[model samples]
Target: MHDHRRLGRELGLFGTDPLIGAGLPYWLPEGAAVRHALEEYIRDTERRAGYRHVYSPVLGKRELYEISGHWAHYSEDMFPPMDVGGEQVVLRPSLCPHHAVIYRSRSHSYRELPLRMAELGGMYRAELSGVLGGLGRVRAIHLNDAHIFCTLEQAADEARAALDMIRGAYAALGIRPARLRLSLPGPGGKYVADAQKWRRSTALLREVLDNSGVPYEAVEGEAAFYGPKIDVQVADAAGRESTLSTVQIDFHQPERFDLHYIGADGAKHRPVMVHRSVIGSVERAVAHLIEVHGGAFPAWLSPTQLVVLPVSEAQLPDAEAFSRRCARAGLRAEVSGERSLGARVRAARLVPYQAVIGPKEAAAGRVALRLRDGRRLDALPADEVVARVEALVSARRAELWEAEGGES
Candidate 1:
């Protein structure tokens, strides 16, 4: 198992302190840097997928939950209510209810059939003490949360578009889903006794998956109480699979909220709601990234992408100049621990990549790039190195690993 606590300390990422109370994470500078990068990627993807970004307040009236059925079903996970004037208010547990409120704010036409709204929402849920696990599970969690409002006829296309965005995101992280599982509620599961509704919704999802040629397993008894869902699973280092992302179709919420849009026939019709999380919970995704990369992030997402090691004081100027160039390219670069040439190189390897440039490389306007695993690529021009690093980060290409024996 990966020693997450040790790694977190070593990287100066996050920590739990008694003063902060239980189940709350204190993100240090390095942790915040990683989080910001992740949020930027998520924002970019959502924009590309046609989602309009909105900021919702952290607290909502208790009546909002009561109207959404969340107060009855999920009251335990919610923070206890506080008195706001004479009425009760509580922190938002999820973004869907808030998004639904936004949808109810406007009148819409068929032209605006597929309305996608998203938020990088910081939400709170009261968790039992036993459930807190570093960044994996916390009471304070940030989500790349979004809800898509679509007409019944446009549901399948919207779902596929969301899936495509998710795939693009995983591609950037060098992660791929080993399995696709489609969950449909059965008689004993979370589904309400609306047999015809469940059948129609499940069939539509299956048809979309079949048409896309995406192989998936039908998981009975795994659907959310609100609707059926599709989950993407990733294999960890130990070969255990965990859900990395999910797409849920919520048919019941729109009806419950009385959400409607004007149709081509000039009739008001209830819209379908789709909840998608390309990276699931940001906290869980960060923990998974640390494990999958073994704390050595790739060129793009590494907290400190490269450290410059100077041979001696005379070479410090060139090294500082080189680090600045990297910073100019939007890469995280630094220089520190000036010591013996060999010692500095060793310390540099402790990070993901160490760029050693002294009088020689600097005089030649080149840099010697070294990997953490003792591999070396030498004497590349600075511009070339920057381009190569950007490409690797953009592609999220995985490094080759040694085979245990030959492939079976």
Candidate 2:
């Protein structure tokens, strides 16, 4: 198995310390670089999709979850509540409750029915030590969560659009879903006991899935306490399956928090909440990416997208200047010339792009370009090379050479 725990260390991606506890893992510079790129990509994507980003406290008052039903339905997986000056607060296990409160803070009109709110937020879970391993299952989770407050007639379309976003994201990130799961409440499950609400929500999700024509399994007991959901399932190298993306239709929160909007008839009406995640947990997504690509990430997602190496000590100045130029052009670039040319090139073999400058090429203001797949182009002008790479990275193209035109 291409276990991320081993590969993370081998690639200088992440680390853990006993003092920081087992469930928490810290990102090394390389890992953090990849994570930052992912975050920016998701944020840009969300912005383009009309999502309004916000920041909410990771800690919430105890009564908050009680109203959202997390205290009753999910407290077992939550950290123990802390008392601050005789008031109880808990680290949130999910962002929906906080988002629900944010929606209720202001009045809304029918025109703003689909008020989409997004957050790249942190949530905590009390996972058992035995079940925790690597980034796949950690106590501290960085979630790419969002909620869409739409009317009843708009719920299905929003869910479908959310699925489209998920598919777009998976294609861009080079992720393949093992399965599509329609997660519904199981018998005797600890779910909100609202039969009509459950039926309506489940039917809406089913309609979306059916209309999309994507094959999926309807699994009982895989749903959230508040509603049913569409889960995008992915498997690691070891064939262990986990959900990396999800979409849910929640009616319970809008009612619990007395959420409403002014309707066209000038009457107060409840809004249906659609919950979606492009990348469920950032950690698990990275862990899967590491295993899926075996650490040779796509160019845009790679920590060090380009590495410039000098063929000899004499070319160091030229190589360093060229690398700085690449960096200035927004490529994650660096210079590596301390070792022999062959050794340094070999070290950066998995890197997406390598520019090897020899004495003649350096003097000519050109580089011997090497794509990670072992393709080499000789004596390309350094500036032209940078332009190709910059275009490729900015476009998030999946293949080299193809990015010069179309994706492969």
Candidate 3:
């Protein structure tokens, strides 16, 4: 296992202080960079999947959770209550209830039967202090959460779309598809509401998986109390499995919240809801990425993508010019003007790759790219260098990308 605390401190990512509340992470610049990259990727992906982003308050009336049934099933994981104007309020632990409210705020017709709402859901769950680790486990987490309100007939299609989004996300992060597993909710009391509904929902999910030719395991009693879900498990470098995403079918919430839409028959009918997350929690995904890549992220995902080292003071101008060219090409490049080539290279290894340019390269109008593993690709044009870097980052080719960094 990666020494998470050491990695966080060494990378200047984030750290916990005794004075600061436990389980809450204060992101430093580097950490925030990684987080922002993740957010941008997920937001773009959600948009491509037709999810409308929305924001919800951090706190809501206690009755919201009560109606959502979270008060009964997950109350232990919630924060302490607050008395507000003779009514109880609580921090929002999930975004489903808020989504329900948003759905009801606008009148709906069968024409808009599949409305998908997404949020980078910042939520609080009262976890034990000891369980919290750097960006892996935190008190407050931003979830790539979304809810799809679809006609009962559209549930399967909506679920297939959610799974596709999840796969796309993992691929963008350079995670192998084979290492991720999907789990269908098991039989019995694992799901809330009627047994008949559970059976029907499971059948629907199974059909979706089969029609899509997506293989999934049927795990018993592993779903949330409110609904039957398709749970995603990701395997790390050491083959340890972690829950990363979920696609759930909810039949109860629409009824509990008294939500409905006008149907073809001009009658109000309850719409089925699909709850999903590509990356379950921002904090968790960061932690997984750290281990998955062994703290060496790909170019696009790297906090500091490139460090330019000048061989001597005379080469500073060339180094600056090269770095500027890289920046123009959307590569994060930094100039190491004051440091020796060797020292700069050593320091750059702390990041991913170093673009070490010297007088020879300046005279040649080319640069030798240094990989983190002590190999050098010599005498490549500045534009070719930029293109290669961009391709590696954009593709999220972590294995080759990290090896490229290591070779330098």
Candidate achieving the largest lDDT:
2
Worst 10 residues of 3 by lDDT: 176-185
* TM-score of each predicted structure versus truth: 0.88, 0.98, 0.88
For model 1, what is the C-alpha lDDT against the true structure? 0.79
Please give the lDDT score for candidate 3.
0.80
lDDT of each: 0.79, 0.93, 0.80
Which ranking of candidates, highest TM-score first?
2, 1, 3
- lDDT, model 3, position 378: 64
Candidate 1 total steric clashes: 0
Tens digit of per-residue lDDT, candidate 3, span 1-408: 465557767778877777888888788888888988889888887897788999999899999999999898788899988998899999999999999999999889999879999999788999997777677678898899999999988999999988888878887786654333344455454346577777777788887777877666777667778766777776655565668888888888998999999998999999999999998898878877777676678667888888888788888899899889888887777898775667767777856667767778889888887776666766788887888787777656654343355552
Write model 1 residue lDDT over 327-402, tens digit each, in one string. Answer: 8877788986466878877666647667778778978988888877787876789887766665555554455122
Error of 2 at 329 (Å): 0.7
Tens digits of per-residue lDDT, candidate 2, 1-408, equal 488989988999999999999989999999999999999999999999999999999999999999999999989999999999999999999999999999999999999878999999999999999999999999999999999999999999999999999999999999999999999989887899999999999999999999999999999999999999999999987898999999999999999999999999999999999999999899999999898888899999999999998888899999889989999999999999897888888899779999989988987999999999999886788999999889889988888766344655
The numbered model that scores best in TM-score is 2
TM-score of candidate 1 on Cα atoms, chains taken together: 0.88
Give me the displacement of residue 88 in model 1, in angstroms.
1.0
